[model samples]
Target: MEPPNILSSIPFKQSPLNPGELNLTHYCMSFLLSIPWNDISVTGFEYLAKKYRLDVFSDTSNPNEVLLSLAGKIILIDVIIPTHGTYRDIRIALAFADATGEQYKNTGAEEILLSAIHENNTTLLERNVALLAMLDRCSPSVQQSCFQYLETLKSTFSLIYTSRLNTQAFNDETEIIMSAEGKPLNDNDGNLGLQLAFWKHQDFLYTAKISMNELPSNSLPCALYGSNLVAETPLKTSGEVSWLPETTMTQIPATMELLFEDYHIVFPEFGVQSLLDFLQITDLDLSENFLPYKTLLNLPNQTTAGYPSMNKSHIIYLGGIDIPSRSVHRIPYSHPRQILGIFQYVRQYLTLQTIFENVKLSSTRITATASLRLNLIMKQYPVIHIQYQELNKLSNVDPVIANVSVLPNGIVQLNSIACGNTPINEDTALKIQKMLQKTLNIGLVLEFAIPKLFNNQ
Candidate 1:
């Protein structure tokens, strides 16, 4: 059995009133006038009709119940007015409820009417009540029109209620149920069922639905009737390969275990004497290193006899190098330069050796564990390390460093020189230390190493 489309079951009648000529105010007044009020006073009814410019009492047959009926209709539609003008309006509006002995009751139509009269605005109350009453007898098209009109009025009365009714009507006409897997299911005995399908292509997913219903005259799917079931188009993209410029070396243990046996090779502990021996053996001249230290040390000796004696205060320590006390024999200026030269050479050599060891160990570990197939692939592509010496170099133009200490555990400690002209302050030093620790994931300690004189001196 073929099921009928839900849309065909809803009755859609045209309204008698032309859409363009609809006026809510006049419609409400007219609806009130048509109601037969058979329980109202002749004098009071005439007063109300005159107040609103409405002619509702032309043929008053039952004077006793005429006003009562009018009040009942007004209350039924929930019309209300404020009590601004001396109890006159409230007295007349609640007259019917009061006469029927329902004025003081806590619950019922009468109490609601009395509350509405005391609280709500009369103008908005009348328009909303009239619109609701008229909508009951209105055709679907006319109801849609009236709904639009009520929206523009912004009365905040029956707008939500009327919109809900429209939505209910739409839902009833279109009975669509979508399953959890996004399949549209139709239990109705329709001509044929439609099925929606999805397919994944590369990184994107595409969706389409097919129906057995008769195709439209201009549909392109009809042209492929007896030919291939599907068609394909190639998508274009740039063929360039992209690579990350910077990659970190994974952290390996300081010591590694061997399957068969273990052996360790400790590098010779080179000192200042070893460096001196190397310099002498290589026949390297130490004149360049001695020049800067010598110039500074000779300042006091060269001063004229009449000139004020240049004390320890005159000698400024750059690079945070400690000076011997006056009482103790002063070491020759040549010693410090020799120490510095040896320190610089050893530091550079150790840094390079560490890098070589790390790279070699990493390659050996990878080769041992990799499968035969992986080994062949890896042999074709060898590991390469890119070294940038200046990547972490400090700016020589600012933030002068007095001394630097590199610990065995990969910690680099810096001491800032205390000079009146030096740019680095406590705050700037702290910031640099934190940034270094965060970026390199290493320990960094900063200290101000100013030279202080003892009381004995």
Candidate 2:
């Protein structure tokens, strides 16, 4: 018994432009063209595009529906404009829904378009209707191109008349955000095909092509990949390690259950405290005006500070972006990834202790379960917790925090930085022992006290 391959049996071959296919493809292309080039001019996107071979997705000969299938490989996407177009009269790949980025210009269609969303802005609506009519005549991809070129043109000509500008809006205890910094300039060809050209410099690189016949079904096992999860943590890196050898990828596989489906927290301004927590860092000598909280909280797509495509993988609060709380419900995907979180509090604790043993105490409350997660991740490594000790006076020795681990009488060793600016002195050691007694319920009872060193040396 011969069963037919459904796609093969139903011919899409009569013409790549058969009227039915043509209508759907053209309509889809129109919508695609409406949104092109991100409002932010990060060229790494094009570098990414070329790697994935997405430039071909715009080939006039290909069917537009192919895009709906190709959406799986994309983890993050930004659109300057968005439309609620359908493919073949069906909601295709609804999981990859879009949120439009409000157009980034002002005093023109850009302002009108953004304003129309919340109010009865008729002039903007009329202008947009005309824009849509022209958009309908085109393919979704070409429509995207229209906006992409518009961005370039604005960059070039607008700069001829304008001066350098700084657009930072929010700077507080909350976050740090980068700026447009420079004007974007591109050719008439637009940036799509030109994107993702270089290797090695990009965060992640790959290419893809879609054919209905070759598509994987929704049931296939897939894992989400996120690189430059900068908001998760930064390489404060008193030292540096090679990250691009792709060595960071653990054998951990797709089973590493993602807590979120996508991450769209842009300009991803993390608070100083939040940043410190995620990186498991001691307090830093940070300057001010560093980060900005983004505009994605229940924010509408394509609207100022937000867009539609932020899907479930997108988070509400980046770790250390706020106070650590196990009870902070998913009301906002607003929790730090717990496993790496413990070191935040512990690191600061150790640093303060090492520098100011028996000094004035600075008490801060951190949740406990996060420490459990951190311990789980780092359990493989041997650690010496010089432990916590309260200060009776500013003159009391601070706890030590550094990376060197040694056995008794082995060699000179350093403490982990989660404790102090300097190594523990003898009296400071007693304080640490006392603090541990009050904090943890169990541990090995080492019959030794810290030995004095610096003064003797």
Candidate 3:
């Protein structure tokens, strides 16, 4: 008979996670759309405005004012379209409204509005294509209404809009800040420094600076100035983009070498040594076994503490490389609980690596073990799982058994360790125990989840 699968017998269930402040999906302000007053109608627009009802002034004298009805409550939305500026420069005002039509003062409304608008935009775009293909089959009036809605919606829709007088757009403010030459990139107090650059060619913004501390004393000063063409997308309408070197140009920091400037997208993987150096974590003497399984990188982004919004920001989490397949799986940092749980697993792996190296130096043979049990404690429930893997192979050696646990506050605790020969010395044993109890020293936490646990297998 074959040996039983350790994962098959364990019971696993979905548990609620306390994401804490790490969740960046929600925004402080509500979402808004800025279509012209004439476009709001009874027939062709129904698909776009499903549940919410729009009330436009019939007097034609007050075309700038529009009211939105949500769940029988009416909220005001101002429609202001500038005649002179480009389509990208137009600004509209929007905010969350409750059932009573007043402003929704509660947090988390932005997440709902963002989701709703994205869904609406997707449906409209999909239908617009189908209607265009069969335009010749329809009447002139239907064609006129359909074309009006599509054109107005495309030019007016935006996530970054002003609800208050002091509200500033992200890209515009970032451009001005980068252009100011004489000022230092970081404040003298050494707080988090974040710099963002929009790449027109790639259509995705790249983070220019994301360090928690100031640059090295010997490092060159930041040499970033605002680009001339940040949002010029005339070629995008035709669906045919011609490559231009000018579009790829970015304000490079003086610290980055030529190699880094070219392939900066993969900085999370290549910048590990820089992170380790900054943290002052030296003399690791890392082995192949430890490097493969214990490595992780935190994506660079601004802190969420006291920040107003995160609707436009992009977040990424990267974990260790799978040696066999050479595939790296991304860990979603949607919650603080998920991050802590993954880090707990990495702590266990590091402890195992230390034990193996100590044994090898002492000329003691250690037989590969089959099972290790780990407990992950959360606020609501405690998760128990078993790992089956061998550190190394050796002849005439004793098998080892280890049990580990992680407290809710992210402190790793070594429950027990057993070996037939007691090959681990007191000094080595004490060192391993400390490594188990250590907390992560990084400013932001990036973690690795047990593949089985995340997959709910």
lDDT top scorer: 3
Tens digits of lDDT, candidate 2, 325-364: 1110001111112212222222222222222121111232
lDDT of 3 at 443: 9
Residue 358 of candidate 2: its Cα lDDT?
A: 18
In candidate 3, what residue range of length 10 has the lowest lDDT sum?
441-450
> For residues 152-247, could you state the per-residue lDDT of candidate 1 as single tens digits?
222221222233224432252111111011122221112011221111212422222221111211211111111111112111133111211112
- RMSD (Å) of each candidate, 1 decimal: 38.1, 24.6, 24.2
lDDT digits (tens) for residues 122-172 of candidate 3 = 343322222222221121233222222222222221111111112342245
TM-score of 1: 0.15
Query: Any runs in candidate 3 off by more than 4 Å, and if so which?
Result: 1-74, 81-89, 94-394, 421-457
The top-ranked prediction according to TM-score is 3
Q: List the residue pairs that clash in candidate 3.
A: none
In terms of lDDT, model 1 sits at: 0.24
Clashes of 3: 0
TM-scores for all candidates: the values are 0.15, 0.17, 0.25
Q: After superposition, how far is residue 106 of candidate 3 from its true place, in Å?
A: 14
Query: Which is superior by TM-score, 1 or 3?
Result: 3
| Local lDDT at 300 for model 2 | 21
Report the alpha-carbon TM-score of model 2 versus the true structure.
0.17
Local error of candidate 2 at residue 59 (angstroms):
22
